[model samples]
Every structure is written in structure tokens, then in C-alpha cells.
Target: MYHSILDTSVEFIKGVGPTKADVLKKDLGLFTFRDMLAHYPFRYIDRTKFYKINQINPDSQYIQIIGRVISKKVIGDKRVKRIIAVFKDETGIMELVWFQSLKWVDTNIQVGVAYVAFGKPNLFNGTFSISHPEMELYQNRHLGRGNLTLQPVYNSTEKLKKFNLDSKGIQKLIAGLLDQVIPQVTEDLPQYILDKYQLPDKRTALLNIHFPKNQQDLNAAERRLKFEELFYIQLQLLHNKQLRQLKFKGASFELVGEKVNRFYKEFLPFELTNAQKRVVKEIRIDTQRGVQMNRLVQGDVGSGKTAVALMSMLLANDNGYQACMMAPTEILARQHYASIISLVSDDLVKVAILTGNTKKKERNILHEQLENGEIDILIGTHALIEDKVQFKNLGLVVIDEQHRFGVEQRAKLWRKNVIPPHILVMTATPIPRTLAMTLYGDLDVSVIDELPAGRKPIETRHLYEGQRLRMFGFMKQEIAKGRQVYIVYPLIKESEKLDLLHLEAGIEQLSYQFPRPDYQMSIVHGQMPNADKQFEMQQFIEGKSHIMVATTVIEVGVNVPNASVMVIENAERFGLSQLHQLRGRVGRGAEQSFCILMSGNKLSKEGRIRLETMVKTNNGFEISEIDLQLRGPGDITGTQQSGVLELKLADLASDQIILSEARNTVIALFEDDPQLDKPENSMLKAYLQKLQRGISFDKIS
Candidate 1:
């Protein structure tokens, strides 16, 4: 009953009829009064301060003046047409010009009438002018500093402008709707929260956000709205997390027995870093609780996350349960299988590999071994999740690069056994803390911040396209020392629209500089046949080739320790995360490594920052923070598709403090009233129940 007024269709609003309502729906996706209410203004302009016509210079920004139009005239030819009016204030005169809506503006504008004009002033030759200024007749509005108030400026489109629905027109319609709706607006936050935060009620916030009485009220309203939006998201995430802990029973891997101890003592290559040890302990606690573990393990490239994963799986093996690791691509799965095989002795733990590349006869044998518990550990691509593949006792599931697979596919691993196994999702791309808090809110996060010992930081450099000869000379020097080189391109083929260096042309140009017999280059890309691609890759891996030129397909899964030089062509065309990953490919060996970022002279501000960031620091966390600032949360590795970061107003980059506060607030609420069963929290519980009916966190897995 409380929401019925807000749920009324926008077409029923007095100022918005069928035609205008359709326009609003198509342009802004605003269908109801509720939608219109949430359509916030992008900015606010102070209408209290007014400048005289004589005071506005070229530098004056968005000033308002009380003026009267003395005369109007049409100037210029039809192609360069405009309507110009001589507008005079008490002090002096200026020009108001309009390029569009000439007929309507010229027709309705009256002569010698007191009016208020708002726009940025420009010095047109000798005189001052304001083009397409917003004009309104001064009835009771004042232009003094004492009566301080803000006027909202909303976002609009050309389509909305056709029907006299620009920012000002939209504001007028909202004003009318607020008059009828404000009385029925219920408080979003409870009284205790409102008092603690010193927040205005929903009624005052709605009134002040659109037409703030003062700067103080506006700030309070913004805080209220931003907090509430982030608060609800954290609530849903926490609620789902709590429900899962209560409902699901996890397979207990109680025995950390012989295989794990032997792998650490004999098979393990290096001592584990302190960060990795901390993360392993965290995961151990989660698995021992007998509650299903849904944990995300984050680390940079060459951080030894695989070692942690291997040790965890050995726990399953010790407990007499099978484990599987799934990757999105066959190459990655093969790489993982090879890495694990090299690290573990097959006598204690039998490890097997399965992928799309497996032969039918071999697959049948592998399947039979898997079902009969002959396979202690299985590593594969999407083939591991297929219905035909069944495990004797699936106890642990590890997903590499979790963003590449859909939610349903990962969820399939949960059903492999009667009880869901411990889930460990790994990603080399470091996520910012704010984004991590929101996107992976339902799961526990552990970051391996420290790189392995004896690993030297790769020296990164930015070179312009004109330095191609110099780069090739450096590549020759690196290859002369028996070190391999990787040259990556953004595009596989030439694209007329983009000016990026494509692989085909890039390789052709390089072949001339470093001739065939001396250079011995191997080319790889996505378009190549799998067998051919592997053949080229093998040549590079075995040190048969001095230079491996490829596309970003070599970003992951390819780890050649001898490849000490990475040259990325058109580095500005890629984002920070991609550039960081490409840089990680070269720094695997004990030898000194270098990454050369080559770009065109012409670069966007963000592109420059990306290249500069790579050249400045080797920290993946810092690079991810900068990437979040540049590209935002939505574009960061398909977080938009997950729907968890569908924020209305909270910016994950700048609103970190607010996000943290909201999360802490939700945590406190749950701590005080674990199930929202207290009388004081009744409103929050009811709101969650209603909102949950609309959104399914389960779909996100």
C-alpha cells in the first residue's frame, strides 16, 4: 500500500501525457513514478548568484543574469543560421544566440521583458555572448546571495529535447511529481540509523536532492542516498552468505596426511612466502569447519598460487576424496596439468589430465579411471564439468580465471557430489578492495601480495613508434645471449578503423630487421589451427626460436622462463590489466628481464597513464587500483555481467570509504540481530524480503 503511489505509471502524471511518456521510457528507461524519483541530477547550479551583463567575461562559467530582450534578429545564411537577441540588464547589454529551436524560441520570446538567463559566457570578437542559454521570466525568483538555493541539472538527450523536455523541463516535471509523492514517501532507514548518522528522512532527502534549500542539506541528502544504496547491496550479499553457511554441508577433509607433507618436504621447489602461508591457513580453517568453502584466491603472476592449490588438493587426497581443477581454455588446463605434474610425484598422488584435445579412446580410459577412484586428482578445461565425467568422491574444486566461465558452469561443480565440495576460485588479476568487497561479497577473499623469493622485478620501458629500430637492436642483443623474446600485438589482422599494429604486418616488418636464419621467429595467434599453434609454441618453449611474435592470446598459459624480453606493439590500445599481464610473461626467470611498451605518439590521457603506470611500478595491486580509477568497476573483467556491482550512484573507485562504511554497518546490524528478528529491525527484514523477490543472488552463483 505504501508503494502504490510510487508504482503509478509515469503516463498518469499530469505534465507527462502518452507522447512524452513514451519519449521518457525510450530515452531514460523511466516507466513509473518510482523510476522518475530515482532519476537524480548529475549536477547542481547555484541560482542565487547573478552577474550583470557587463561583469561576465570569457572566463565566466555558467553565470545567471537578469536581463530584458530589447530586439531580436535572424543573422547569417541558411547553412550558418542563428537567431540573435540583444539582451540588456540594468548595467549593460549582451547577445543571446540560438542555433536550434529558433522557431519556438523566437516566437515565444517577448521584447522588453525582465528575464533570467543562465549559461557560460563567451567573448565573441569584441562583445560578449551566451549561446543556447536557459531563459525564464523572473516572477518571484531573486538574484541575491542571501537567498541561497541550488537548481538541479539533469542528463537529457536530443530526442527528449524535441518535445521541450531538456534538463529544465525534466526538473519541472519532477517538481510536480514530488508535490504529490513527498507526502507518501516512507523513510528508507530506521529511526535508530537516521539518528546515528544524522540523516534526514526520505521525504526531506528527496526534496533537498532536487531542490536543496542550502549546500548543507544537499550534502546530507547525497550522503543519505549513497549510504542507503550501498547498504542494501551489502545486506543482500551478507544475507545470502549467512544462509549458505546455515544450509550447506561441506565435505570434511580432516586429514592433512602423508602426500601433503611429502610434497612440501621433497616435491615443493621453493619455500612458501609468508603471504601464501597466511592464505593457506585461512583456507584450511574454512574447509575444516564442515561448512562449504566458497573462497576466492587472488595473486599476481608468478606468485605461486598453484602451490597453495596443490597443497589444498593433497588434503582431499589424504582424506580419501578426489579433487578437480577446471580452466576456461585447453591451453591453460594443459599448462596447469603440466605444472602440477612436474611438481608432484605420481607414486603417492595419481594426477591425470583431461581436455577437449583428449582422444576418444584416452577419454574413455580416463573416464573409467575417474569413476573408479583410480584418478586421485583431475585437471581439465570445461570438459571436467560435463555430465559424462563423474568423480568417485569429488571433494575439492578449483576454478582458474573464474571470470571466464558463466555462473551456471561453476555451479555444476557443486552438484558433482551429494554434498558440495570446497570451492577455490583463483584469478591472477588483482581486484581493488572496494570492488572485491562488492563483487565477491559472498565469498572469503585471500590475496597473495608477496612474490616468490629470488624473482627479480622486470624493468619496463615506454617507447614511441619512431624507436622501432632501437627496439629491434635491443631485441637482437637479448637474443644474442641465448635469451628468448616475446612480441605481442593487440590485433591479429589489419583493421581500417583502428590504427593498432596487427600481428601479420608486425611480424612481416620485424622479419626484415632480424633476418630468418639469424632470428628464427615463430608466429602465433587465435586464428591459427590448434596443432599449428602448439607446434609454434613448442619451438619457442624449447629455445629453437629466438623471437615469438603473437597476439594477446599468449597473455596467459604460456610460461617460458628463458623468454626474458617482452615487446608489446601499440601498448596504448590495451587496458592496464592486460598490459600488466603481458609484462608478467617475461619476468619468470632468474635472468634480468625487460618489457618494452611501444605506442604511437598520439595517446589519450588514460592511455598515457596506463603505459606510465606499467613503466613505474611492478605491483599488480597498484596497477589494478589505477585500472579501476580509469575504466571503473563495470569494465573490469566482466563485472558488469555478474550484476553484483550494479550500483546506482556509488562509484567503486572514489567511494571506497562509503562502501567500507556500508559494509561495516551491515555487519553490525547482523551482529546485533543475527536474523533481523529484533523488533527494531522489523522494517529492514520486511524490505529485504520484498526486494529479494525481485533479485536472485543464486543466479550469480
Candidate 2:
């Protein structure tokens, strides 16, 4: 059995005592041997060769040199001492200077002693020199593997330094540990499988990664590990998909009769976009089929996805089954309830709201109604998952802004009923088609590509810090026309510790500029309680507050048709997709909306490019594509987002084609010999077993 080194205490390891172990545990979170093993080198230092002192040009880059100290002199005072030494190599002579460690260097260095010095080469006056260079005493037997190859450099805490354990010390410890852990190369995979895939043994790969002799070995080790990590993740996802498909069947709501048709003809405020109709049709067809529906409906902000969701819920109600919509926040859940209540006949379709703040009596009543199938649709936050809550024949479960929830939470929802409800996850963030395919490979996806009639696009603009006065004047003009405004800051509280700007300062500045008595203003941020945030949001939505200065907490939920202007402070601080989402909060109504991005004068090149892109187009998909190019997939979806399949060797952005090929290879192998009972297929099974740690691939069987 393979053992984790994390089980061993740091004190048990050689070179680490009680004092050092305490520092490691408290400061670096390194309590065991495995922690140090996993703490991979941040960078490598090349010490392959040494340069002659005289041969070194003034403009030459950093190089190591072997030289003998000819003379040493103490120049400066005790408080600011400087030790200057003259050294001569085979080619020429140079000066070696030490600043703070003069006493140590003076005692250690002896005239005519040959030693190795490593540092950057620079010219001062007309001579070549190295200041405060890292040096080692010359001894043929004590060379300590002098600059022979690349050396791993680790990261250590200041506390470790106090205990005489720094980066170099940690590196030596890891090197010694590698020497003791004998390679236990078990044949987890068949020999034929290893040959076909050209994979190294697991033990060899692990050892080489920590102590590689050359670049080729490092590359091979990395390839093996990355592939193994991604393969296991993919295997787990595929297995989950199989288990879900086999274990649960959705209640198919087939009829599209009076209620859906009546709402479409009379109650619907606007005609359905062709994209919306297509997605609705896809959902209807999926529900009609006997299998559980796991689909993702992605659309750009303001693309009318909520309308499609409401229509699907209506379909379920007509077929005599209850449906529920779960949002990530209370405001969003309330918004959906209000919007749907306005569009549907309340008598025909009963709707209820359940949030964390719901009264206990009300919750009990709602639970009873939900369990008895009296409520047609229930909308809420995560409180919907409480053990007390039950649904009578839950036909459909629509998750809004699905990325906010984790995989385990989604799985919990699926288990609420014996036959899992038809799952439709919706997101306003428009992901590119390629990324969508990998991230949501298991789910059938539907896209809503159009907005409703009279939905005007917001005009976007980028302004430098110098143009803030002009932007303020423009905001005043917009406010004069009875339009509300949202001025968003980046932080919640003013912190004396941080050098960055805070939201409280922005609120103070805006209050001075727009002066609260003249224009009513309110502030909201994450630090505020939920009720206070909702109260401030309510004031803005009711037109009681003319200008609301808040943080990105308003990015997802707050919907105000009257708010015509969106001003994002420190616009460069936000990611492209986030900026787009914030911009989407406005332009919800017929009145033309404006998005003003205020950036600091000193902006990064990428930041400038991001701002320029935001000004160029309102298409969230285009912005997402650019974001993928600039920041990569990890930042776009966040590292923990469920749909983001973590890859080891392949980049989801750059190596899409390669990933497709690998996926195809796996699929073809599985299809040709499902159980892998044949000899040729047995190797593939071995490869899968080596890759998928605990997850099983019995779906093929």
C-alpha cells in the first residue's frame, strides 16, 4: 500500500528538532513529512559553471567565479560597516564587497584563500565587481556539489529562519528524505498498458519530480503526474454522470396545453426571441423523454433566460407536478417570485418563497404545502435544502446562476427525491462554446442568444482618473432626467493597514460631490447585514435613493429598471467577465443606459486592454473569450467551480484540440471492448486503474 508521508511528525525527520518543528508547524503549516514533500520548489537556481574574474565583461550577466582573496580591508564604521576584498582569478582581478556582514566575512576570509563566489556582475567606475556575493570556503573535500546543476529553491517562513531553517535547509531535508524512500514500484498497471501509453512508473515519476537529473526527466515526471490528476478527475465526473443517469428518472411533463399557451398569448409582456423558443423546445423534449434531464442553459446577461425558466415551470404546473427554482441569494429568489407572480395567474399556480430569514411558522406552513403538492412552485436560497423541506413530486429543479453552488450541494439536491428532478442549470455569464464543452461535458447544453424587443444596449466608456470631474457632471445630468445611478466601489471598509483604496473613501467622495442632501445616497457592501443590504437595495429599486454607492455584492442580484447609469470605480481592478456582469445590471429597461468605467492613470497593459474591450462591445461571450485568452480558465471559473474540470498536463484554453483527441481515444477504447475482457483492452483498463485512484469505471462493464 502506498503511504502518505504526512502522517509522520516533523520532529521525527532528521535535521528538524522541537524548536524548528514548532516554527514549521505554526508558520508554514508543515506538520508532517508529506507536507514538505508536497511543498515543491518555487524555482531552480542554475549553478552549472563558473566564470573567470578577468574574462567577465562589465556588461556580463550574473555568473559564478573561483578566485583567491588577495587582500581585505574594513572601510566603514561599526554601525554601517563595509568590507572590501580584492580577488584574482586566472584571467583578471575584481573587487568583492560585503555590506552588513563585514565582521563575519572578515573573520572567515583569509588572504590567499581560494573560494567560490556567485552573484551578478556589474561595472562601477572602470572595474568589475560583485557586492555581497554568496560565497563558500574552498576545500576540495567540502565542495558540497558545487554548482554542478540546477538546484531546487524552496519557500520558508521568517520563523523558520530564526531557528536556522531557511529555504536551503528545507531543500537539504527534502533531498535527504528522497534518498531514504526506496522506490516501491508496484505494477498497478499491466506492462502492455504502460508500453502503449509510454508512462513512467508512479514511484519513479514522484522521485524524479523532486530530484530530477535533467530537464527531460522533469518534463516526463510532470507529464505523468498531470495526466494522472486530470484522468482521475475526469473518471470521477464520468462515473458520477453514469450513476446519476442510471439511478434516477425524471417525471416527464409532456402536455403543453392551456396554461402555457394562454400565458404566451395574453400574459407574456413581450414576444419570445427565437433563441428562447429553441431552448424551451429543447427542455420540453428532454422532459418528455423518460431520462433525467441534466442540462445547462447559458445566455448573456439580459438575454431573457428567466422568461424561459418561468415557461418551463408553467409546463410542469400544467402537468400536475410541482417545480422549484433555487437561487444563490435572497434578493434573487425574491426577484424571481415577484417577476413570475406578475406574469402568471396566482389562483391557477401557487408560488411560495423560502429563505433563511423565513419565519418558523411560515416555514412550517410552506413545508406542509410543499409536501402536500399544494404549492406549484417554490423559490428560495440554500435554505431549500434543509431536511424539513420536502417536495411533492418535484418535477423540475432549476438552479439560477449555477456556478455559485458546489458539486456536493448539487448532488444533495438530486438525492432529495427517489427519482431525481429534471435538472436545468442557468447562468447569465456567456461562456465560449469550446470551454463549455469541456467544463460541462456531461450535461446537454442550451444557449439563449437573443434579447427581447425594446431592450436597449448600454453604451460603455472608459475614462481616466483625470476625467472624473467630467463623469460626475454627466452623472448629474442623467440624475436631472430622473434616472437613478449606481456608483460601485471595490472594498467594504477603510483599512489603515492596506495601501489600496477602500469603499468608505469612495462613498465619502461621492457624498461630497453629489452631496446627500441634494441627491439621496446609500451604501451597501458585504460587511453589512443581509437585512440592511436588502433595505438599501429596496430604497434604490423604489427610486427613494438616487445614487447607490456599493460593492460587487450588487453585481448578481439587484435589478432596477430605473437605474440608467453604472459607474465602476477602479474599473481596472475587476476581471473582464465580472465587469461585463456589472455592466449587465443596467440597460434592463427601454431607456438607454450608460456604463462609465473609471480607471486609474497608472494601469497595467492588460488592464488597459481589458478596459478597451469593455468599451468596444457589450457581448458577454466575446468578452469571456478575450478573458479566457488573457487570464486563462482558472480565474474565469474560479479554481473550485464544479464545472471547471481541473487538468494536470493540458491547459483547457491552449490545449483544447489535444484534450479532444485524448477524450476520443478513451471513448473509442471503451466502445470497442466495453468490459475490457479481451487481452488488448485489458491494458487500457490497467491504464485507467492507474489513473483513477478510488473511482471506478464500471460504467463500461
**Predicted structure with the largest TM-score when compared to the true one:** 1
Best by lDDT: 1
Total backbone collisions for each predicted model: 0, 1
lDDT of 1 by residue, 322-358 (tens): 9999988877888888899999877979999998889
- Cα lDDT of all candidates, in order? 0.87, 0.77
Please identify model 2 stretches exceeding 4 Å from their true place: 1-42, 45-183, 186-221, 271-275, 360-365, 406-412, 430-457, 499-505, 515-518, 527-532, 604-613, 616-662, 673-701
Q: What local lDDT score does residue 432 receive in model 2, on the 0 to 100 scale?
A: 74
Predicted candidate 2 versus true structure: per-residue lDDT over 489-556, tens digit per residue: 77777667744457877877787898757899878888889899889888998999899888898888
Prediction 2 global C-alpha lDDT: 0.77
Q: On a 0 to 100 scale, what is the lDDT of residue 522 in model 2? A: 75
Candidate 1: the clashing residue pairs are: none
